[model samples]
Target: MKKPRNKFFQKNKFDQAMTGYLFLLPALVALLVFLIGPIFYAFYISFFRFSFLEPQNAKFIGFSNYIHLFQDKEFLRALWNTSLYTIVVVPIQTAIALFLALIVNNIRGKTFFRVAYYLPTVTSTVAVSVMFTFIFQPDGILNKFLENFGIHGPNYFNSPTFALPAIMMMAIWSSVGQFMIIYLAGLQDIPEEVYEAAELDGARGFRLLWHVTLPLLKRTTFLNVVMSMIGTFQVFDQAYVISGGNGGPLNSTLTVVLDIFRKGFKTMQMGYASAMAFVLFAIILIFTLIQNYFLGREDK
Candidate 1:
């Protein structure tokens, strides 16, 4: 009789386990096919000499692809360009976003302000790039505006010196609003009593903001910085659109992702491209971990 009871309980436990797995089946299947599959496939290809153009010609080359990547001048230039973009853009954008959020938070018609500011963020990157391409031309609106002030503006996309900066300027302008919204949300979460208490302690204006607001908004700043850093590193669409897929005028605006696209698709060097991608992944991971260590520690 005791053995029969034990068997009944075991059978019921197996049925429950099956039901749980059944409920999770669709999500698990999707993950395995989409996310997990591509990662493993890319990793597999990165160790070989592979080209999608001639799939039958694949040969295992161990770490040669990665080795060659470091020796490639274009890849090295792209890595430097991307690092520069990330380093310059992240802090500037974060600061601008915080400034905009603070201004909007104090203003009337906050909805209108938010909508106006966030318009560029929601606009398609391709469309923005195209528009800016025209605007940065020799005789375009920007140059015309500069002429009015007795200053001359160079043809932005055509010059190596100004090309990257033009992209950086446009990138900062378009992205600030999105991060502003994030900062605005974080600003709202601060208890009013905190401000009132600070006011009683003679904190006002910049003093209040510096001593109270910024310190409290550290987590929001952390999120914005991380997101902005990642986005800046992976920037491709605008660079592609602006440079017309050549990564020129002298590869000034060539980002890591754009270089990867050029290698994989245009040049048909899929294995090399995969290795470059993993290097980018490693760089981003390192930066993110460093940020987390410092910023997260400050939060604690």
Candidate 2:
């Protein structure tokens, strides 16, 4: 005899699938309109001399904006600053995060320590920048502390030599907690049996970490490196807030995103800004690809 068809079950399944799509509709529509739409619009406007102040007079400039970007010394400086920031901050932050994760993983009262470590990550970037601004001032707490040791601290925001380093320190401090959480999660995933086996083979303490833990956490390290690189390259809020939006101190803290904001909003060079945005996007893509290649190669 032929099996009886469950038409009711089929209908219910169809209805549930429809409901799922209906539920997702709002978020999908919002993403397309707000995020995807702006990306394409930026690309379209990059080829034109679009002026936000005079949108009616926008004219096609072909690749002129892109060509001029190469010759724009300020833009070049911003790119270099951003690249240098990424190069310096990523490794330092990754190492700090990994070290914190390792320390927390082996400690008791883990929850308390985790919460305490993550406070900075949860705090607002603007608030932290404002607080640091006061702290880094010439006569601020940092300088006062230095003076106790008979060393004078320069005004961090006003000194070209110290401005970028000050920002780098802030970025690392704020970011390490978040990445530590990620590393902690990765550490838990490592099978205890693996460690036990390594111990049986005479691995202990630093040897275990240097061999098994680090090797197994390669994927997590790659993730953290890529994330930190992207964040460092696009750093703007702290730089903008600390520099008061001008990227002062001889443009030491000027980043590509801040430069784009200046060009797009301050100068109303919308097309040029859009072009720079794409260039930044390209640079990020290239760096990410290179990192993936190197990391993936090492994994093999």
Clashing pairs in 2: none
Among residues 3 or more apart in sequence or in different chains, the pairs in candidate 1 whose N, CA or C atoms overlap within 3 Å are none
Total clashing pairs in model 2: 0
Q: List candidate 1 stretches off by more than 4 Å.
A: 1-24
TM-score of each: 0.92, 0.95
Model 2 misplaced stretches (Cα beyond 4 Å): 1-12
Q: In terms of TM-score, which candidate is strongest?
A: 2
- Residue 79's lDDT within candidate 2 is 92
RMSD of 2: 1.7
lDDT of 1 by residue, 1-300 (tens): 999999999999999999999999999999999999998899999998899878899999999999998899999999899989988999999999999999999989999999999999999999999889889999999999999999999989989999998999999988899999999999999999999999999999999999999999998999999999999999998899989998899999898999999999998999989999999999889988998999868767
Q: After superposition, how far is residue 21 of candidate 2 from its true place, in Å?
A: 1.7
